[model samples]
Target: METQLRKGAHAVFNIQFHIIFVTKYRKSVINEAILSKLREVFSRVCEKRKCELVEFNGEDDHVHLLVDAHPDNNISQLISFLKSASSRIIRKEFEIYLKQFYWKKEDPSFWTDAYCIVSTGGAPLEVVKEYIKAQQKPKM
Candidate 1:
C-alpha cells in the first residue's frame, strides 16, 4: 500500500493501523449483507473521525480493517464508536437473522470486547534504524 502523508496545521503524519474485531461468543452470524452494512458504517465512522477506511473485509465471525488515521485521532474511542454504532444498526436491520445467535432476552451484543490493533505502514523498523544510523553527523 502507498503511504500518503496528511498535513495538519502543525504536523505532517502518515499513520495506519490494522484492526480486527470479532463477534461476541465467536458466533458465525455475519454474511454478505451484514458485511456490506459493516463496510458502510465503518466508512462513515472513519470519515467522521477524519480518517479513511483504506480496506475492509471479514469472515463469518470477525472483520478486518485497514485504517489511515489522523495523528490527533483517539483510536480507542474510534473503535468504541464503530462497535456501538454498527451493533445498534445491525441488530435493528437484521434482527431476524441475528435472533438465532442472540436471543430476545439477551443484551444483543455484536462484537467482542477484545480486539487486535497493530500499527502499519512506513518502512520496516530495522530499515528505518539502518537509515538513521547511516545519516552523516555534523561536526561540532
Candidate 2:
C-alpha cells in the first residue's frame, strides 16, 4: 500500500496533500468554536500559500484536512503554516477550553508536532476526495 501510494509521487511534480494531525497529547479541545475559527484561519493561510482547502473537520482530539498543495510546497511547510496561524488565533481568540490545555501553564501548544501526509493528485481528484470524505475512526 505504501509503495503504491508513493509511486509516481517522486517523478511527477503534481501532487496534492491529504493531511491528518492531532492535538498535543491528543487532548480534546477542537470543539465547535475552535473548529469554526480554525476553518477561517486555514482558509486565509491556504490562500496565502496558494494552496486549496478542500475540506477540514475535526472531532475533539484530532483534525483531518484535505489540501491541494502544489508540488513546490511540501507537507511540513503547509502544516507549519496552518498550525502556527490557526494555533495563534485559536489560543488568543477562543480560550475557554484551549486555555487550560495549551494556552496556559506552558503546555507547549494545542496540536502535536506530528502529521501524516499523502499525495492525492496521483489519483483522480474524485477518487482521492472520496477516500478522504469517507475517512472516519474505526468502528467500535
Candidate 3:
C-alpha cells in the first residue's frame, strides 16, 4: 500500500481507512457487471472527495474499500454520499437484475444503513504506545 503523504495548503498527512459496505438484508445481488460498476462509482466518489481509492473489491453480498483521505474531509459525510450515490446509480442501472433480490419496487435500497470504517497505516498500536511511553518525562 502506498504510504506517501499528501500536502494541503497548511498540512501534510497520510490518513487511510478501511471501509466495508454490506447489501441490504445481505442479499447476494452483486455479479461481475455490478462489481465493475461499483468500482467505477466508488472511484468517482473518492475523487470527488479529494481522496484516493487505493483498493476496492467485493464478494456477492459485501464490498471493501481502502481509501486515502484528506484531513479536511468529514468521514461520515463521505460515507453517506458514497452509499447514497452508489445505491441510486446501481439500482437505476441494474434494476431488472436487482429486482429478484429486492422485491420492494418502490425506492429499493442497495446497502444497509450500517457500515464499518477503521483507520489504517502508520505503526502498530503497541509500537505507538511504547514510543509514547519512552518519551522523556517533564522535569519536576
Candidate 4:
C-alpha cells in the first residue's frame, strides 16, 4: 500500500479510515454492476469531500472503503455523506433489484443505520491491507 501523507495549511497528516456499511437487514442484493457503481459513487463522494479513496471492495451485502482524508475532516460526517449519496443513487438506478428484495410502501432502506468505522493509523498499512483482503475468505 502506497500511502502518501497529505499536507494541509498547518498540519501534515496521514489519516485513513476503514469504513464498512451493510445493506438493510444484511440482504445479499449487491451484484457486480452495483459494486462497480458503488466504486464510482464512493470515488466521487471522496473527491467532493477532498478525501482520497485508497481502496474499495465489497461482497453481496456490504462494502468496504479505505479513505485517506485530512485530519480536519469529520469522519462521521463523511460516513453519513457516503451512505446517503450512495443509497439514493443505488436505489434509483437499481429499482428492479430493490423491488424484488426490498419491497415496501415507502423507499426501502438501502443501508443499515449502524456501520463499522475504524482508524487504520494504529497499524502498518500492509497489515491493514492484508486484513481487509482477508475479508473475502470464509473462516476455517
Candidate 5:
C-alpha cells in the first residue's frame, strides 16, 4: 500500500519501518504460492492498518518489508500486529506443517519470536526502498 502525499500538512513526516522477520524452520516453507500470498496478506494488512508497504523482498527463511507509517501509530504495536496476523494467515491458509512449538488446538506459530527492526530517522524514501530491495537472504 502506497500512502498518498497530501500537501500542506502541519507535520508531514515520512516514517519508515524496516521489518526483518522470519518463520521457523520447516514452517511456512518457501513456496511460490506461499510467498505470494504472504505478500498479498501483508499488503492488505497495511492498507487496513493505515500504513504504506513501500517495498518487500525475501527468500525462504526471512522477509524484509519497508513500511511508511503515520506518527499516531506505535512501532511495536504495528510490528506485533503484522507479525502475528501474517503468521496466522499463512498457517491456516497453507496448512503447512507446524513445529511442536507452533502446534496447538487454538493457535499456531508461523513466525519465530525473534525479529529485527530499523527505524529510519528522516531518511529519504528512495534510500529505504533501496535497502529493502537489496536485503539478502540470511546464510545458514
Candidate 6:
C-alpha cells in the first residue's frame, strides 16, 4: 500500500496504528452481521476524524483495524469516539441478538475497557524520503 501523508500548515505526517478491541468479558457475541456493521461504523468514524480506515477485520469477540491518521489527531480520543459510537449503534440495532450477552447487566458495554494499539508503517524510510522530496516544498 502507498503511504498516505497528511499536511498541515507547518507539518506533514503519516501516522498509522493497528488497533484491537475486544468485547466485554470476551464473549463470542460478534457474528457476520455484527462484523459488517462494525466495519461500516469504523469507516464512518475514521472519516469523520479525518483518518483513513485502511483495513478492518474481526473474529467472534474482537476486531482489528489499521488506521492512517494525521499527527494533529489524538489517538485515544479517536478510539473513544469509535468505541462509544459503535457500541451505542450496535446495541441499539441488534438488541435482540445482544440480549443474551448482556441480560445480567443493567447497562451493557459492548467492548472492554482496555484496548491494544500499535504503531505501524506502510513504506520504508528511503521510499518515504523520496516521496517527501518529490513534493513541492512550501514557499518560504
Which candidate's lDDT is highest? 3
Give candidate 1 misplaced runs (Cα > 4 Å): 104-106, 136-139
Could you tell me the TM-score of candidate 4? 0.82
Scored against the true structure, residue 67 in model 5 reaches a CA lDDT of 87
User: 66-134, model 3: which lDDT tens digit per residue?
Assistant: 999989899999999899989999999999888888978775689999999999988898998999999
Point out the higher-scoring one by lDDT: 3 or 6.
3
Instruction: State residue 12's C-alpha deviation in candidate 5, in Å.
Output: 0.9
lDDT of 2 by residue, 44-124 (tens): 998787677889888988878887665556667778999888877877787775657665566546678888887665567
lDDT of 1 at 109: 81
Clashes of 2: 1
Listed per candidate, the RMSD to the true structure in angstroms reads 1.7, 11.6, 1.8, 10.6, 11.4, 5.1
Residues 74-126 of candidate 6: C-alpha lDDT, one tens digit per residue = 88899999999999999999999999888756766799999999988877778
lDDT by residue (4-58, candidate 4, tens digit) is 6778899888888899999998999999999999999999999999898999999
Query: Model 5 segments beyond 4 Å from truth?
Result: 1-10, 25-28, 96-107, 121-140
Q: Which 10 consecutive positions of candidate 1 have the poorest summed lDDT?
A: 102-111
| Rank list by lDDT | 3, 1, 6, 4, 5, 2
Q: How many residue-pair clashes does candidate 1 contain? A: 0
Clash statistics: count for each candidate: 0, 1, 0, 0, 0, 0
In model 4, which residue pairs have backbone atoms overlapping below 3 Å?
Answer: none
Tell me the whole-model lDDT of each prediction, alpha carbons only: 0.92, 0.75, 0.93, 0.90, 0.76, 0.90
Q: Per-residue lDDT for 107 in model 2? A: 54
| Model 2 pairs in collision | 24-112
lDDT of 2 at 117: 80
Where in model 4 is the C-alpha error above 4 Å? 1-3, 122-140
The CA-based lDDT of model 2 is what? Answer: 0.75
The ten-residue window of minimal lDDT in model 4 covers 1-10
